[model samples]
Every structure is written in structure tokens, then in C-alpha cells.
Target: MAQQQWYKGAVIYQVYPRSFQDSNNDGIGDLKGIINRIDYIKSLGVDAIWISPFFKSPMKDFGYDISDYRDIDPLFGDLNDFDTLIEQAHARDIKIIIDQVLSHTSDQHQWFLDSRENTSNDKADWYVWAEAKQDGSAPNNWLSIFGGPAWQWEPRRGQYYLHNFLTEQPDLNFHNPDVRQAVLDNVEFWLKKGVDGFRLDAINFCYHDAQLRDNPAKPKDKRQGRGFSEDNPYAFQYHYYNNTQPENIEFMRDIRALLNQYPGTVSLGEISSEDSLATMAEYTEGGDKLHMGYSFELLTDDYSSEYIRTTVETLEQRMTEGWPCWAFSNHDVERVASRWSDNGEINPTQCKMLTALLASLRGSVCMYQGEELGLGEADVAFEDLQDPYGITFWPNFKGRDGCRTPMPWDDQHAQYAGFSSHKPWLPVDMAHKAQSVALQDADEHSILNAYREFMAWRKTHTILLEGDIEFIATAEPILAFYRTLGEQKMLCVFNLGATTASMPLPLSVVTEHNELSHHTGSVNQQLLTLPAFGCFYAQC
Candidate 1:
């Protein structure tokens, strides 16, 4: 038998550090806060915790626009506090996977500060710098994912610098060997600190077209791309020349070489390009690149079983030798419960069903914070909103602030769902209070407990984690698939609709797990019936 990799069957929990937990009675969550909750995360049975960026940042794009890669921001705590967190988490047997925003740096970063000063500086080539056209407009038609043009002209340097997101987040020029080495060195720093892996943020946007070519217009049907808004002008471009450069392959090799030295460490890239799925496939096509890559394909509003099956199958077919990571919710998009709901209301049954469905998939899994409690998008009003993207595209898009709210821990703790004694950075969704961790802990049937039970149960099924998946042909609302690894196989079925569904079965049940099966589900000989938002797991 081939030796198994630790991450192959691992489950990752993503935490937006600023909103996870707050210690020292501060309004914002800090590293100490995360340290206090280490035991709570340990109870989830997740293998690793992918903490979002807590590095030194001005909070322009939250921690995504990092000013320093090596230091922890004061709002999150100091380096010493983070060291304690790593120590405590390691003690609990939880691996740490930090969020690495390598594509861009905060405009305030010393590298960018020096690069923007003069074209002759040693750091001038560290960022994408281009001369403006004769009309004095942007060099090309590239637009920022936030709202306006991708190019920001620096008066001091007399050249436009590229920023795929907000102007404060300037794109890094990976074409510069020095820039690539610096990124690798920073990554190595974390590996030496005992981090198990890295979640590379916007990995494909590290390099852009050297010719400064204008992007062609995108077809009308293809509007949405990662963080770009439907109303934003950025949706009009195909984003071909601006990102997903071929040089990224070589850079990935360099990153992989560094990680291989750490032994057992892994790299998962977040790809956002014109053809993000294709980019994901290409980036992980060879073992030298990313160990796994996840795209925004499954994060959208599409919830039909057909769409889910097609997306996974398509990626599987396209990937020659790549492993894929699937996530339905993250800090960026709306909660999957709200986005995938049928009638615009949060259904706990549907929530439980999706949890089982996501876990039963073939690849590694990632569950966002508060998702275990079946929390939906927090309704942040205009006055309570903090996301710049939502603020820019108000009325049309409310921004990601709704999904970035603090996790509701307890109603009895304080005003902000036990997150902090002071006012929170973002408003807590009052609706989440009822489903808080304290309340759900006592209820065996609660989504919180269900997630725990399902995850614990899934660990026994090695086939479900590392097996090859083949989608079973079925009608709408009913998604069925078989996870097979040689003689070990498990047939998983889920009804994603509001109404009951039934289909004929071809496999016989060897053992049935009662804990995970919804009471509304049944299988008799050749017939299978499932209630609305029901599921059945049978070993064949």
C-alpha cells in the first residue's frame, strides 16, 4: 500500500481571525482570543485550522492587504501571542494553516512605499509599474475587483501601479526573481514556526501581462468572477492578460520545493481567473505545483444537484493529475445555507443535508466558522456595514460584511453573542443568537451536534475521503454518488430540495449508519425514498 498523506483525508476549518473570538475584552478578535478557543476548535474533529491573515495590516482590505508578512497586527495581537497560539493548537493536535496573501501587499508596505517613490529604486520592480497612455487614462481596460480601474497612477513615480482589488492593495510583481524569493522566504519563516500548511490567497494574480495588453470584452453571460460585482465594470473584461500568467507554474515549483523541505507541509492555492476552473486544473496538473486548488465555481448561488454534479465532474475530467479542494462557504461569499436555500428562509433540515453532502464528497473539505451551527448570512444594514466592496456597490450588492460577522458563541455571555464585551467590529446577527454554541450543545439534533457526529463518523470511512467518486444518474433535487476504493465503497445519497424524492437503487446495504440518516429516509430492497432534505449512507 502507498503511504497516505496527512492532508488527503484532513478536514480544514477556516477562521476569519478578526471575527472568530475576542480576548482581553476588546471589540475585535485577537490571537489571544483564538488561543482561548483552541479547545473549542479541537472538539470539531478538524485536522487543521486555516486562520485568515492576522499579519500587520492597516485593515484597508481587512488583513488581505498585508503591510508585513512576518509580523502580527496589533488588532490581532503580537508575535509572542501568535507563538502561544501555535503552541497551544499544536498541543491539541490541530495543524495550523495560515492565510498567505502573496498576490498583493498593502500600499503602505515598505516595498510598495519604496517602489512608488522612484523608477530607479532597488524595490521599484517589486510591484507592477506601467506608464500611462497618451490620453493619461489607465494603461489598459483592466478594472479592480473592488470597483474602478486596476491601475493607480502614482504622482511621485509618474507610472500606474496595478491593484486587482482595492487601490490600497497593490499587486506584487512575481516576475522579479527577488520578489518571488522574498515570498518564498516569508513562507519558509512560517514553516519553521511549526505551521502545517498554507492557504495561498489569490495565487493566480501574482503575475500580470508584461506587455500591458488590454483585456478583451467578456461575454454577457459570464459576468461574475470571484469578488467582482455584477454591476461593476470589472465584470465586463475577460481578465485574460491581467492574471493567470504562465510564469506562475515556475513560481509554484519554487514554492513546492520550499514546502517539500518542511516534510508533510502542503500548499493549497486559491485561483481566480477568467477560466478559474481551468486555471485550478492547470495549477495542480503536476505534483510540482499546488497540492490542491479551489476555485469560486461552487461558491456561487447555484444550488441545484445537477449543477453541483456537473461542476465536480467537469473539474475531475479536466484535472490530469490535480487534487481539488471543495468549499461551499468562506469569509468572502454569503453563507451557503442562505445562498442555497429554496424559499429565501433558513431551513435547518436543508442545512444538515448540505453538511452531510459536503462531507461525503471525494476531496478534502473546508467549513467556514459558524457554519457548524447552520448560521446564515447576517443581515448587516447599510449603517452597520463595513465591507468596502458592499459600500461601493450598495443597494445592488450589500458586500461580504454579512458573512464576515462574529461567530455567535452564547446568548448569555454579552451583547455580542459572547464574542466580545466591547462593541464588535461588525454587527452580530441577532438571528444567530438562538443557534449559538451553548444552546446547540444541549440539543442532540441541532446542526452543531450533527456536524460533529457526521465528521466523526466520516473519519472511519477512508473510501469517502480518498476514494474515486462517480456521480449516480438521478433526477432533479436528488444527488447520489458512490465513493469507491478497491473493495471498500460507500453509496451516499442526498435530497437537496424542499420536497421528498425517491429513486431506484442498484447497490445493497452492508451496514447502515443510523446517526447520520435522517428519519425521513428509507431503503427497501430495490427502492429508496428520501424526505425533503433527507439523506442515507449505506456501505455496499
Candidate 2:
């Protein structure tokens, strides 16, 4: 494989900096902490580590609201610390993929500050600003994903500026060529830092409709998914005009052009649109855009054989040329261990099955921190919640804080679970201590060990890495698929239930069973019986 295409079929480990580890005992994870843990990340057998945004920010929406794109925030240490992290991680053959939030910037950003100063400032057209209507309402009916109106009134400009997220985060006006160039310039700044790739956060929201049109309303039943609860007015609309604009295609090409200049670097877009699967397909098509794209389709509460099959098939059908990346948990959603569980419980066997299924799919995969340990979502109380989104929706929607807690390093540590000497920003889940890396390292059957073994095994099978996928017809709780690469074929079957599942197979017996596979299934008389959450892999 070409060095530039290393991302294809690669496994990326996502490290949420604030929660990963703290090196300075300051209660917040820093770049030096990541540098200290390079061996742990490398041991997981991931090709790259996609660190969430640690850029300079006012912390309104955490690091997503970047005030300075090229500089590291003091809370996460200085740029020198980041450089050391890059050097250490690269030494371990691990690529560093940083999160790049391109759609918007913190209201405190110099560009937005200058733009809001006057109508004719040098950066006046940098952000999306519009004049209010005669009634003095918002420019249009577009809504912010966080809640309320998408338009934030700026007294300085005497006009409303569009904010697709928190009001403090003003959307950038990609319609202006200068704004686009400046964004690319910031991206180039990172490229010069020896980074391998970028996880483009909310990349689809870069451009909006120039006409400032109102988004069409959706039926009450359709106002679901994409992490928005029914109570959030942002879900009431189809979100057509506010994002996924046609102009974004050209911007994607520009990003691709810039990336083309740097070989061995790639772009993986995080797309959440009205039709995210279709948008994922569109943004990554023709090899002139994103190298790979992933959406929230699998991060949802729905988990079943049919749901998994259909989601992958739909994307596979629409995405012919570009690659896909799959993730079950991330900084934005609840942990998959709890989200997919029957009664909000964590099952180690089920997690192993999920990893096998995810890694066996057609494309690359993203493993969030703590996922290998089978960590469940933390139940943060209302008072402990730090996310503004959770604070807004309250009881009905507790927001993302449940999933953003600090990582537990040692179970014996009295306070902060060895994540920090001081009280961390968010409380570490106490239940996770038993599943800490130190504890799991000694248990051969632990989820962490299983993940390491499976990843190491997966690297040996090129068929599992670069093969075409075809689903096998199976009943509920049983998902079967065949991965074919040239003349090599591997049949992957999974039992996704909490009980033993039996199904008829076409073959009477499986002659070859790889010892490295985590299989608890048996094939006899053309009947396949799998233990709860068991998986079977064999040459077909």
C-alpha cells in the first residue's frame, strides 16, 4: 500500500484529551500526558491516534469553540508540548490525527471580533451575518443544534449572525474566498507540524444557503436521531438550509487539493446532515474529497442485526468510490456498551463481539478511548453536568457529559481514579475502576486483552482489512457476512444476543478455524450454534 493511503482499512484510536490523562496534576489532560502514554496507545495496535481539539478556546463548548486555530490551549499545555507528543507518537509508528473544527470559530476569535466590528472591516465578511427582517426576529427560522434560534444578535454589527451551535460559536462564511483560504492556511500550519491526518469535525456545516432561507419543518415523529431529543427545537426542522450546501463540494475539493500537496496525510470527515449516509457518500466520492467519512448512524441507541446490516448496506450502496469509517462510541454519544445493552448494563462478551463485527466490516474503524475496556456510560447527575447542551435540556436530555468523563487508570487510586492527582474536570466513573487498564492487562479474557489480540490478529488478515463485504441472510440476533479479497474469502458470523443462537448454514462443516479468532460457536450437521455474544470466523 502507498504511504499516503495508510488510512485505508486503518484503525484510529480517538483520545478525548480532557479525559485521557493528566500529567501536571492540574485536573485536566495535557499533551504531555499523551506523550507519556505513547506506549499504551501503541500497544492497542492502532495505526493512528485522533486527538480531539486541544486548540486555544474559551471553553464555552469545550475545545470545539476554537479562538486560535494554530495554537494549543494553555489548559492542554503549550505548542511545545504538542510537538513533543507528535515526536514521541511518531517514534512508536503511530500517526497523530488532530481534530480540525472548520465550520465555526469562537466568538472571541480575532476574525469574528474584527468581522463584528463593522460592515467594511478587513474581516467583515468572515462570518455569516445578516440583517434582521422588519419584525426584528431572527434572519430565518434556522435553529441551533444546542437549542433556541440559530441567529445570535450582535449589537456591534446591529445584525444577526448565524450560529449552528452555541451562540458563542459563530459560523464562518465560506462564501468568502478569503475565509476559505484562511481556513486552509490554518490547516497547513498543522500539516507542517508532522501530523498524519485530520478528523474534520462537523465538516458538512462549512457552507450554508446564501439566500438565508428557512428550513422546512419536519413531522413530530421525524424529529429524532442525530443526537437531538424531541424537546430540542433544532430537531423540529429538516436542517436543509443551514448545512450541507452545494458550495461545500468545492470547499472539499480545495481541502483535498491542499492535502494532495502533503503525501501520507488524509482527511476523515465527520458528517451529520439530514441524510448523513448520503452526505457521507457525497463528501467522499470521486477521490477528490475526503479520504474517508463516518456519521452517527451507528452511534445511536438502535442495535440489532437488521439495523447494523441495513446501515452498512445503505452506505455501501451510496458510497461506491470513497471509503467509510465506523464507530460505535465517541466523545459526542453515550458509550456503546450501555447504549447497545439491553438494560443499560455493560457486557464484556458483547463488546468483544462488537469489535469483531466492526473490524470485519469493509472500511476503516475508530475506537474511542476506554472502548477496549468495555466501559459503560457514566451516569452524571444534573449538578455534576458540565456540558451546556445537557444543562439546557435537563432531565429529558442529560447531554454528552455522561460520555465525557475522565479515563480511569488505576482502581486503587482513592481520588480521580489515577487520571489526576487533583479532582478532574468531570468525575471518573467509579464502576470503571475494575476495568482499568492495569487490571485488564493481567486478565487474558478482559475486553482490553481481547481487543489487543483481535487487532493484532486482524493485522495479519489482509482479507479482513481490504476485502469487499457481502451480507449473508440471517434471522434476528444473528449477523453473517462474507469478506472477499481476490481469491481469499472469510465468512464472519456473529451472535448479538444474550443467549445462545442457532441457525442453519450452507456448509456441513468448517474445515479451517483460525485459533486467533474469538469463536465460541460450533458447526455440526450444517447447524451453527453460537454462545451469547459469540463470534465465528473461518475460511469459506
TM-score of each: 0.97, 0.98
RMSD of 2: 1.1
- What lDDT does candidate 1 reach at residue 340? 93
Clashing pairs in 1: none
Tens-digit per-residue lDDT, 1-540, candidate 1: 122277886789998988999897778988888888888898888988999999999998899999999999889988889789889988987888999999899999999999999989999999999888899988888888898899898999999999999999999898899999998999998998989899999898888989988899988897865655677888888888888989888998898889989888888999888777788899987788889998788898888899999989998888869888899999899999899989878898888888888878878888999989899998999999888999999999999999999888986445898999889999888888888998998898898888888888888878877899999999998999999999987888889889989988875765474656443587777788899998887778
Largest lDDT belongs to which candidate? 2
Candidate 1: where is the Cα deviation over 4 Å? 1-4, 507-513, 517-520
Q: Which candidate is the best by TM-score?
A: 2
Report the C-alpha lDDT of model 2 over 412-434, residue by residue, as the tens digit.
56577789998889988889887
Over all chains combined, what TM-score does candidate 1 have? 0.97
Clash tally for model 2: 0
lDDT, model 1, position 2: 22
The 0-to-1 C-alpha lDDT of every candidate, in the order given, reads: 0.87, 0.91
